[model samples]
Target chain A: MRSEEYLQKYHGVTKFLRILAQISFWLVVVLGAASLALGVATLFMSSDSFTFNFLDNIRLSMDGVLQFDLSLANITATTKKEIITTILFALSSFAIIYGLIISQLTSFLKTVENGMPFASANVKRLNMIGILFIVGSFIINTVYGLVANKIIHALGISTLSVNLQSDANMLFMGIIIIILAGIFRYGSYLQDEYDATI
Target chain B: MAIILRLDRMLADRKMQQNDLAEKVGISVVNLSNIKTGKVKAIRFSTLDAICRELKCQPGDILEYQAE
Candidate 1:
């Protein structure tokens, strides 16, 4: 593509990513503050119980012999600690993943804006995002699983269990991004060589 | 360390300014400056030919080799 078209494309993408990055930053700050507030609130209201309605339906069919439908028809009650922990876990996980991805994108777009998309800094940022996706997903899922189990036990719900599942798709995507970062690094080297050839 | 650019000396001997030579050679002043300062890694044959044509000098007059 011509340099003008290339720059225009990057300019538009950078503008969009800047907005996204700002939003993600605010969301992370708000979520962090909310988690802290919830912790403090829990300390004062330790004995209170909160009820949450299921947002989706759970369907079970066993060999056409029995079928059961569970939905908002189900409401679960839990203590203040359980509610706070669950909310904090979910919010923190979202904030962490969203913040990492957006921050990397912002930095990458800035490099492109400077007319150097194959910069060494962009490679590092891409690799950082890749590592965050892989490790963050694992940590978030594990924390959520542990928190859910603890909450279920605290609620005296003996029939329910929390199972931890690793996200293979996220891990695969992270690896691909890491590989792309390597390719970008190589591209940066080639660009340098080309520029040096006068 | 071996190849050296004598563009500045040649331009001085020809009594021509860098900008005039750059204009005649049809290259940016920045690129011509880089060539004169020996900051560039390699020179294109077309660029060398243009510079030689503009200065009315052989490539040997613009470039010299000295062992370091």
Candidate 2:
């Protein structure tokens, strides 16, 4: 309340939202990746192996949630179906993770725009974002390794072996962010004490 | 916590309403109430000056130090 006048006059919430919107616009890349994956799956995969049970499970879940009828069963190709299925699975997993990250960021930014960056809600958001990033990167890495191995086998490329490795950079960054969230929570507690004191 | 506000007592002795004193002191009623209820961590000198001037009392008459 003491700095309300300065905050209201200089801190434009709309401006921040605009910038966030611009950045979030790049999320279109996820859609592009999904489309590209779908195309590649159609080109390389045989019809039988392309609709693996796991892939069908994913499709069925997605269909139930999104109410969309994806007709992947119509393809008559007989080669590289497993590879295609793996690629599509990886892409879909990445898209979901990216969506979660974006949603968390949007909510966190809104709280910041409200001029309470150290609020408990923002702290929780930060923690959630951090955990999501960590878990997401791990999942992506595992999926990528699986897809790579599947593709190698499909292509009869026996010389290469896929190794499972976590994204170290994302893991480290997530840990730092989680620590920052904890610090922010402490700051929020202090802010609450200060606000209540007066 | 050791510092207690005697604002309610002072207001009674001066026969002044909280609303009237808040207006005279140029602060919101909520702020004045916070001060009266000893909820404020600190008071600005300007606000204290205005309150003392309006209430026709010294600072000592409004604030008292008590051991916790």
Candidate 3:
């Protein structure tokens, strides 16, 4: 199909994606706020044995490094507090990064909806998201792993062998996005050429 | 770019304004201005043909090359 036809066909798709991104952005905001409230609430509660069921569901166990004893009955207050702190850290970071990602996606889709998909704005947004993925993935996982190890030591589980692996999927996805941004940059260059040409 | 546009000189030689050339060549004055100022990365063959026809000049008259 011709360029105009292709754009016409996908214009609806971009619009739909923009709407989805907007919804996801707000959801992230609301959920992130709730998590912050919950974390703060737990801090004031004067009990270590008192573990939230939802917190229990969000497991951050590494392979043989740190294992969460899901049986909240057996967990010490210090261990529980440490785990909660770690989870809050991870989740807050995720919400922030994810919020940024969704916002960038919304902006990109808006550009596409306006028939400027190859504009430099979209390229920059993609690059920003790509960098966020790469850096955030490494920092969050490594920090979580380290904090978990500290918890293991605190609990004196010296017998459990520690093995922490970086999230390969997110790293790969970040690399792919950066590559795509490069391609979009080239497309933007061509667009400039086309537009400037008489 | 190595390929330089001499459209400004050609327009001068023809004593023609950008508006006249753009109207005659069926292109916007902005595009003709870009060509005259060497702001465009390339000229499409159809546009080159149109410009040439309107200017009554050869493509070589509007285009030149110089090593940087």
Candidate 4:
């Protein structure tokens, strides 16, 4: 296919990804709120009733008092901590995945902006998507961090004590990718405009 | 960054209006305007070939590249 047609096809796919990213973003927000609520409720619940487990690292051991045909409430404090860590890790993982997706989208937007020649409407919308990804991703990630901190504080835990074990390098890479995408998008727009006059 | 489109210059030099060229080439004036203004990011090889034949000019007469 010709370059223009190929770009048009690419735009279609990117638009789909944009929609998916938006859905995932909202999901993260909702999940973050739910997790915070749980953390707050956990603070009010009695320690004896507390139960949690992590994957393969710790075993669930309940208080040996209530032993009337019980098979569920068998988790220890260590297990609970591990479980919380796991949940935090999952949230961070989702954030990372979404970040990478937005990074790639921004890159593609830049490529389109670079004088590949598209409908003005298409070009405008693509730029808008790029802006949305950059701004929305940052907002969502920031909110996630803040909410996690709030939950930790509400549970009488030091927020800084809990660290999600995502690679900092990867996060940095995602940010860089996004920044480059924005730059490219802007450059492409200017080029497209100048080319018009030529 | 310095890619140059000379299609407009060529058309001007030939004293040919874009509409006339579009008519001669059997294409819409909108498409021809896209080429001249570089609004269209790309032109199909067939379209380029037609434009060249109609204008009696080479692709080089229409496009030039300069470094950013």
Among these predictions, the greatest TM-score belongs to 1
* TM-score of every model versus the real structure: 0.77, 0.68, 0.72, 0.38
Estimate every model's Cα lDDT from 0 to 1: 0.75, 0.73, 0.80, 0.57
Model 1 per-residue lDDT at B6: 99
Show the lowest summed lDDT stretch of 10 residues, model 2 chain A.
Answer: A55-64
Q: State which candidate has the highest lDDT.
A: 3
Q: What tens-digit string does per-residue lDDT give for candidate 1 at A1-198?
A: 997687887787777777777787787878867876675665556343444334235453322455645342333443435555665656666676767787788778777877788887888999998998788768767776776565555556788777787667778888999999999999999877767666
Query: Model 2, A8-95: lDDT tens per residue?
Result: 7545864577467547646645664775678575765446544444333223222134342334333333544655656666776777
Better of 3 and 4 by lDDT: 3
Off by over 4 Å in 4: A1-3, A51-168, A175-179, A182-186, A195-198, B1-68
The residue-by-residue lDDT of candidate 2 on B41-67, one tens digit each, is 788778888889998999999999999
Deviation (Å) of A109 in candidate 4 = 7.1
lDDT of 2: 0.73
By lDDT, highest first, what's the ranking? Answer: 3, 1, 2, 4
Which portions of model 3 show Cα errors greater than 4 Å? A48-86, A139-163, B1-17, B64-68
Question: lDDT tens string, model 4, A1-198?
Answer: 976677677777666665665666667666655665665565556654444432324332222342323222244554445345545554555555455455445544444545353434444444544455555555545544544554345345543443333344445554665565566657667766655431
Write the number of the candidate with greater DockQ, choosing between 1 and 2. Answer: 1
TM-score of chain B of each: 0.95, 0.97, 0.93, 0.83
- True-vs-predicted CA distance for residue A72, candidate 1, Å: 12
